[model samples]
Target: MLDVKDVTRMFGTKAAVDRVSFTVTGPAFVGIIGRSGAGKSTFLRMMNRLTDATFGQIMVDGTDILALRGAQARAWQSQCAMIFQQFNLVPRMDVASNVLHGILNRRSTMQTMFNLWPRADIIRALEILDRLGIAEQAPKRTEALSGGQQQRVAIARALMQDPKIILADEPIASLDPMNAQIVMDALKKINVEDGRMVIANLHTLDTARRYCDRVIGMRDGRIVFDGTPDQLSTGVARDIYGADASFNESATSTAIPTDATADRVYADAMLS
Candidate 1:
């Protein structure tokens, strides 16, 4: 679904993302794991052209994203929805309206002026909310929802775009364990059932191993490891994040119960 070749990004003399390359086939869930300042976020943003690369190319559906401009870039971005660590919803808008914002690219100023989302779009948004199991909260103010619900609302908004690729940057960073599971599960279902490609930058190795089909480890702006979850044992993690990688050992217990509200998270995504 996406191809990144020798992608690099620099800030004057500093290289934030350095010569990273990878391929993402459709219906795959890929995780990027790294410590703080490791450039994982820079790498993901480059895929959407959110940050122009100092060097390298990103190909999505055969078009070189680096070459696109204006409407073309906007069109490409619309096809690649991004979910941030902080659910970036409008605080004053109702949950449903925030989700509908995903299709604003297809709506006009007049339609948007009156919040007149088409019936089909509205229906689709509602369906996405239901799929995420947050349909009952659609009428609530975004700020009134719980952290997990808010993040699911963000996911629903992304789904409203009907995107080909979903980029989640530290998606569960702000959530509690239960909420994290809920958010991660939604992402997993999107990849498995919906067949959309998912690429997420993760801080926790446990989450990466739990949720990703393929794991890519980054350090100081370069990919150090890219392989199946089973391949990321303690030694490999130690190499990527040093001794602290052992901290992830606690997540090994299969006993963690899935909250009823978030059934689809990382539960079955990881290869056993």
Candidate 2:
């Protein structure tokens, strides 16, 4: 359960996120769709409390997340995991250790210094890596893996926290279309299987329509549209992107369903 009311963030004379408001109850995959500079990333940052809101409130349950301080703030951030376009893994560290570091918020300094993680935590990290389809890469150095694999590693690290909410900022922007689909599918899988609410800042309309349960369209730092994917019509999308009538929407599609997607659609549909 998350509620954001009139939240705004300003930089000098500029407002990057202006009076954004929404409520998401229960588990659902929500996509914030927009072009560059639409304040999508800033909005997610504010939700994660990595950047403070200049005004208004973000409530998780009944608690005002903006008001939290010290350990409480750190605890809130831990429960709200973030996955970024850049893998953010320690390149020299083994994949398993990088994933295990997700627990750094709660682990003691001595334990981290001595690499004395409990057996159960290590096993849990392996389990998360396995679930993300990167178990084999666990022992390898993080920099050795492909972009998609590394992103999954990032997701595994987030899952290591048993987080309640997952915030993905331009999650697949740096990958090829195929790898992008893999990462998106992995995120969807997590949302479905674990019931963790996923809020992603997505540049591609096709990805949002195909994956998200709800879509929030932003433009010029304000929420212009909020509805189901089906409601994001051509006109609506045009307004969100500030495009002219002849503007080609196809250019915004980064998700071109791989053979994996086709199998899940036409091929797998036959079995049902």
Candidate 3:
């Protein structure tokens, strides 16, 4: 279980994350949606300790994550793997090597410095690539693969961590519609099949509705809505995005049924 209590992050006098509180128990595919600067990224970063909260406590299971230090803090971070919009990978390295990097934290300094991976770990990396449907690309350079394939390699890397939770920060922002669907499907498969929790900062509403079991809507720095996808009515979306917002651009652009007709269909589905 993950419990966030009165979490707030201040940058000088501005509060990026304002007294946010929520509890998550059991595995779930959670979508965090909001316009730019809604604190969605900040909140996820705080959970992984990439950004520190100015105040409040974050408890994962029975541990107060905010109080961890040094090696303990590093270990905590490893337990919560992060996937970025950029698909951070070593461009020059082979895909399999990039996936193996996930286990560096668990290895000795000399072993890591020498890039010495155990034979078992090498086989495990290959298995993960096969599971993600990218086994053939393992011997290729990471940068040589297409955007969608690279993202799958990134997912394979995260699996090497054996994380309790996966936090994806606007993971599909740079991909075209087809590639985006592939990435989202991969994420959903991870959550449903592996039973690991997935919390993604999503840009498109249709993607959220299609992939997430639970949706968390944020406005400014506060949670405006928290419920199942069916509860995310058009009225609720308007409240989340605002009255004059461009729905076609933000909500339907990368969505499935990507046609002019989908506009009304998406609107009706969201509103109904």
Q: Each candidate's root-mean-square deviation in Å?
A: 5.4, 5.7, 2.5
After superposition, which runs of candidate 2 have C-alpha atoms over 4 Å from their true positions? 244-253, 258-272
Residue pairs clashing, model 2? none
- lDDT of residue 91 for candidate 3: 99
Instruction: Report lDDT (CA) for all predictions.
Output: 0.82, 0.85, 0.87
Q: What are the per-residue Cα lDDT tens digits for candidate 1 across 68-132?
A: 89999999889989999899999889999999999888889999999997787788889999999
Q: Is candidate 1 or candidate 2 better by TM-score?
A: 2
Error of 1 at 67 (Å): 1.4
- Clash number for every model? 2, 0, 2
Highest lDDT scorer: 3
User: Candidate 3 residues 1-272, lDDT tens each?
Assistant: 98889999999999988888888899989999988888999999998999988998999998989888899999999999999989999999999999999988889999988889999999999999999899999999999999989989989999999999999998888888888888899999999999999999997777887888999998888889999877877778778777654444666665644433434554555554
lDDT of 1 at 133: 95
Top candidate (TM-score): 3
